[model samples]
Target: MMNSLKHITCAFALAALLALPQFAPAAEAADQPQRPILSVDGRGTANTEPDMATVAVGITTYATDAGKAQNDNAWVAGEIQKAIAQLGIADKDIQTRNYSFRPTYRQDKGHENEINGYTVDNTVIVTVRDVKLTGKVIDAALSHGANEISSLDFSASNTQGVRKEALRSAVNDARDKANVIASALGKKIVGVQNVSESTGYLETRRFAGNMMLAMAKDVETPVAPGSLSLSANVHIDFILSD
Candidate 1:
């Protein structure tokens, strides 16, 4: 009787263990139903006129003596600054961008290691708050001992409003695309799952080469303040529902 009772208890335990459910494999679990998502990209652009300009002017001088080279460069730079200031530009707007004093080497076969002369370079960045003064500033700097015009760039003073407008347009474009896709799939967009964005603006750049600087002293420089294009891009992941 004792052996029979023990056998019955073991059989009951084995049956209970077999009744428990088995776990599915990872691949099988992945095949289960999931929420549908739609991803799309949208772009928008806004145009606005540039309101300000920046000019980079430099003076370079070479001499056998380092002190003379530095002195000549400083004098020329000071004259250029004075000319810019006379155009109603405040002292704060004129900033020194770069200054370098280095020795030049003779590239001849017999004197490759000999120091030929010393060179000094001084560059200043001038901000013209008024767009109309862009040409005047360039001409003034060139006429007043500025030998090198590195770069000139035009930009808007305030880009906040235009950027916001572009962002709104980008969002609208994304929504329109999402709606079209969802309608084609016999589903409706229920909500937005994720969103990401990037924004940028293009500047109107003008480069003044050596020839342009040489001729600028004879004629008034001409500057065209072209419009700037600000762009926004957005990626949206939308949830779809039947």
Candidate 2:
């Protein structure tokens, strides 16, 4: 009777050990998932003419007295504002960006340590709707009291349409590249698994030199708002079908 009981316990233990391997496969299947077939990146570009421009203008005034410097700066700023108004620019379009007072530095003599004068700086930003009037507005600002011209940038006022076009181009580029790869591998593209898009901005540069700035001086300054190019990139993952 004792030998029979021991033999029965050993047989049950062997059966449990055989069943454990079957359960391991179910756990492994739950942990693992399918992976993608192919991945690629594509780029596209589109060019268009800019419709708007931004102008940065300013004045720098210096005097021995602090009050004099402040008065000069205020006067110049007023004149600049008047000029912008004369150009028919909206009041909201003109923005004051900076105002500051700094002591002028003198060097190279026995009195080099002394402060020579007080200087005041006032800067303004102006947005122009008409590209043709960009030069005219800049000239007007300078004639009024703006002595220094900082920067002029041009860009598209409405960029939504162009951005959509660029995105479409990028998608097409990705598809074309995937087709070529599939053909080389003797396989067909089944579908897209993932896609992502990125964009690039267009910028315009300003030239530096001595120029004339008088309201009555009606000589149109040759302003060339060059073409702007926007770019887009798309990363795609494609599944291959045999």
Candidate 3:
């Protein structure tokens, strides 16, 4: 009986020792301290002069015959295209933005259900590589039978450099904010755990309403290709240390 009791006691001790590894890791993890983290958002902007411009011009014509209306519109559109070409605009730079051919309804009581005439509208978007030639492009279009001007917008041809600068500025801003917050909490940023960024640029738009008036007065349409603002926003996860 004594020998059997000794063997039973030894077996119990061995079993307890074999089970220790499973629970040991959990206890060790519970005792370890967690690292601190700081999250911040930053924004930055860079301004640059516009190098390119886009102009949208339209031509409208009406006639009793649809064929005649379409023919007149095509003639005027061709003339405007030629005029734009004279100013050095390439064929690829000119694109038809919109075109429509529809019959107009007579508003008179007896003719209410009758078709009065056919109207044709043609709109084209012209990309001006030279910002200085924007006004000339508009004037050429108007002089060649373009009756409506929809929009004029300005942008920079090369924004990659500007965008990089803006991103750098945004990262610096985030670092500065993190340092401020960490310092107040009696801690310091040791490393960046993760970072994300988004970038965009805003275009400068010119009013098209006064363009015809300016042309009527026989003065050069004044255009200002103002500065473009490129912006970047960043979200950073900074590791903190005491």
| Candidate with more favorable, higher TM-score: 2 or 3 | 3
Cα lDDT tens digits for candidate 3, 85-159:
988999999999789999999997888989989999999999999999988998888888988778888887788
Would you list the clashing residue pairs of candidate 2?
Answer: none
Q: What's the TM-score of each model vs. the native?
A: 0.75, 0.76, 0.81
Candidate with maximal TM-score: 3
lDDT of each residue in 70-185, candidate 1, tens digit only: 99998998999999999999999999978999999999899999998999988999999998998889889888888778888888889898899889889999999999989999
Q: Model 3 off-target regions past 4 Å?
A: 1-31, 201-218
Those runs of model 1 whose alpha carbons end farther than 4 Å from true positions after fitting are 1-35, 107-109, 201-218
Per-residue lDDT for 129-150 in model 2, tens only? 8888888887787667777767
Off by over 4 Å in 2: 1-36, 202-219
lDDT against the true structure, per candidate, is 0.87, 0.82, 0.88
Task: Please tell me which model should have the higher lDDT, number 1 or number 2.
Answer: 1
Residue pairs of candidate 1 with colliding backbone atoms:
none
**RMSD in angstroms, all models?**
6.5, 6.0, 4.5
Name the TM-score of candidate 2: 0.76
Candidate 2: clashing residue pairs, number: 0
Total backbone collisions, model 1: 0
